[model samples]
Target: MRKNRLKLGLFIPPFHPLYENPTLCIERDLQITQFADEIGMSEIWFGEHHSGGYEIIMSPELMVAAAAERTKSIKLGTGVITLPYHNPLMTANRLCQLDHQTRGRLLFGGGPGLLTADAHMLGLDARESRDKLDEGISVISRLLAGEWVTEKTSWYDLNDAHCHLLPYNGPGSLPIGVASAFSPSGGTLAAKYDTAMLCLAATSPDGYDALAGNWKIACDTAEKYGRTMNPAVLRCATDMHIAETRDEAMDQARKGFEVTQRYFANQTAHVANEGMDVTLEDLIERGEAVVGTPDDAVAQIRRLEEKVPDFGTLLLLDKNWATFENKKRSLEMMMRYVLPEINGDNVSRQKSFDWQGEHAEEYFKTFQQAAQRAFEKHAAQTEADK
Candidate 1:
């Protein structure tokens, strides 16, 4: 078992139904960040999406800036800024600024954008996204290192471009992460840039199967670069919703799951065509989601640990499967019960309790002997007074 406690966090691609108010949806997201910070969650990430009505945040940097003020300790991340859609120089500058704004609490997450619709809106070929992301990270990494970058590409050209401000902790001090779904591209890029690997689909059957293979890819790629992949920075994300009981959790998440899945099915071809008919049982049986009690959540995480063995964090992929209150309750339950169990946080306490139980007779005998001694001393004292 990895002795180091696995950190807990949230990756809020933030699925909201079309019927909800957008303003309130964003506010709730910020509130969740604040609540997570108060409850000592390690971090929270916001996503960038332009075309997806369900995953609406548009600018994760803007969310980070807003969340930075509202939060104190939890690290804020661009769950990913779609690298193919933006100028590397501009993105680097914004990242540097956010690093300072968050007082070094910003995690820069970059990815080839997820949605083809988003790429289409920018008049970009979706096929070129991965290459563009690779190029973008390279340029951004160089610029952030305080190097004068004079690079040219079909999409962008930098003429002696340098960030006005380096990362708050100095160049290369800012933590970087790349999103990996089921492909080796993310692992390859992570090793190339020495960034953390964010296994965004770790709980899905395919993603789970790829865990060891992806780590191997990262390690092999890093060997080429003479750099070692750090398992301590590897983060795995999964869908989870927990309550006091499995039935209660299932009830809370059932309707929301339908809404979100239907949206995914419409926007994402890879999503199950069953749409609204997809049941919570279907997700659980497939190991695609954990919509049950905290014990169920612990089991899901342990299952992941079995595959990867050593990962830095378990990030709950935030969903609106439950109401805001229920969602908050789920997070609370995770911190209060699920995390402690997985990390063995209460092992010593349990041992101490069992030891006391085992020695109950001996302890009672000692107490009785002390009481007898006190009574004898009092009787003698009374006689002396008389």
Candidate 2:
């Protein structure tokens, strides 16, 4: 077999395990992330949320900075940062500062703010989200590019604006990833800007199929604009729980997904009429969440690979706010017992390390997603029997 070279990362969400003590939350998060760095993991990516339904960490930059200082190798990312919530100038400057602070170990993740709570907390309405995201990104992209630009609209205004943001190792370098649950618009932007696409995989291959459509449209859009698109830059996230036995795995996931379902249910109350059909737990049992022992999870993942061969990037971990110990145990199990088996890639580590490798972020989040990419590539290589 050819070398798989797949990457795996622990998805560190802000939501605490459902049973964690509030006082020890910060300490626990630090401990887990540091351990992930020490455990020879590729990256540690977290998302942004306001009003604190689960975890207290909301500022992706602040968290990335703190993670950068503590760990020498593991890549830190916004996992995602909602672009629409802040003044473009300030958000762009801050992200650029983080890039410099981490010496270029930063990923620019573009996502519109989700819940009404997050928008409300920012003193905005969700109805204006798409427009806000586009405007903010327009300004941020130029600001990072050494462009003296201006944007004047009824919504936001910038006059003769310029920003001094240092690019990583080179004069112009920073890998940006765009997060989209199901919007073709994000996929279009990803290709247009040469950024990667992130899809939440906590649901099903059905969700994978849905996101894949966006990726396709993105490429089509790029082609329409006389631009080239590379299918290799795909990214996705999976809600996965691994354990010693199938029953044990299901039990762990039951608790975690229950909490997640409730949290989102409460958050999506006013928006319930949006026709959100499936519960988070339903996404779990339907081969989407991958809740089971290693063998079972592997089978489910392989099926997904057969179906969507170009998918890459995935979030395999979730918040450990309430059940810190349980979550930690699960993470350890995943690292030791589950991950190596699925991708079965060669992993090298030191009690401490000198290099974290170049594609650390991709390697971490794109392991299973890579399977789809691989299956697609592999099948293409083999000639069909006439």
Please report the candidate that would top TM-score against the real structure. Answer: 1
Candidate 1 has an lDDT of 0.90
| Candidate 2 root-mean-square deviation in Å | 15.0
- Candidate 1 lDDT, tens digit per residue, 1-386? 46577999999997888999999999999999999999999999999988878888999999999999998899999999999989999999999999999999999999998889998888889999999989998888888888899989999988989987999999978888998999899999999999999999998888999988999999999999999987878999999999888889988989888888877778545564666666779889999999888888988988988877768899999988899899999999999998888888899999999999999999999999999999999999999999
lDDT (0-100) at residue 244 of candidate 2? Answer: 78
Worst 10 residues of 1 by lDDT: 267-276
Q: Look at candidate 1 and tell me the lDDT of residue 72.
A: 89
Which parts of model 1 have CA positions greater than 4 angstroms off?
none
- All candidates: TM-score: 0.97, 0.78
For candidate 2, lDDT tens digit of each residue in 20-61? Answer: 675577666667788877776766677787764574668878
Which candidate number would show the highest lDDT if scored against the true structure? 1
Each candidate's clash count: 0, 24
Residue 20 error, candidate 1, Å: 1.0
